[model samples]
Target: MGEACERPGSTEDCVDDAVCATDASETGDPADPVWETYTCRAVCVDESDCPEGQECRGVTGAFATRACQPLR
Candidate 1:
């Protein structure tokens, strides 16, 4: 198994109140490792802090956005 596969439980091990993200590494010409890491909700202070393709929507909390929309 690869490095990523070895840590399948890493995400689940995080505290329930905190968010989790996955850090993946890819092999290529130069063996580009750890290309990027997708964050969950742990490091986010606001919706705008989310990645470009994702959005932070609140239901019973603050009246933030309602859903994640496409980035134009």
Candidate 2:
């Protein structure tokens, strides 16, 4: 895959068809800036598609598109 995405908006630079996905659990809290980080993940068909410690999940808004993510 390409380099890990450092920003929070787009995944155009991610390799291996990966997209930039934000951690849902990390968001919604104005007090936490750590949640602003984005991860480069390939779209997943199931949990198996995710890395060992993560799982495939779908969010509701702009992040709604399914991708590999940490378990919530």
Candidate 3:
């Protein structure tokens, strides 16, 4: 569910229950500058909908789309 994708891309680019959402996690290497990547992630309504260590997060404004995100 972590496949890289283009911004504002189509949902067809992801799996059946996933969307091309922004990966909110930190970079693999701390030495690297913070960069944003669009990845395929499962949609969720709340923390209960995500995996054990993830949560459903959105920007909390108009047009904000929620997706499963890692808590760490």
Off by over 4 Å in 2: 1-9, 24-34, 59-64
Residue pairs in clash, model 3 = none
The residue pairs in collision within model 2 are none
Please give, for residues 1-72, the per-residue lDDT of candidate 1 as tens digits.
112212222334344433333333444444444534433333344568656875544322223323222232
The TM-scores, one per candidate, come to 0.24, 0.58, 0.66
User: Residue 54 of model 1: what lDDT?
Assistant: 56
Q: Residues 5-55, candidate 2, lDDT per residue (tens digit)?
A: 665446575776577766544446645544555667777778888789878
Give the Cα-based TM-score of candidate 3 against the true structure.
Answer: 0.66
* TM-score (C-alpha, index-matched) for candidate 2: 0.58
Better of 2 and 3 by lDDT: 3
Candidate maximizing lDDT: 3
Location of the lowest summed lDDT over 10 successive residues in candidate 1: 1-10
- Estimate, for each residue in 1-72, the C-alpha lDDT of model 3 and write its tens digit: 789867533467788877776654375665553547777878778888888988888622215667787764
- Residue 29 deviation, candidate 2, in Å? 6.7
Instruction: Point out the higher-scoring one by lDDT: 1 or 3.
Output: 3
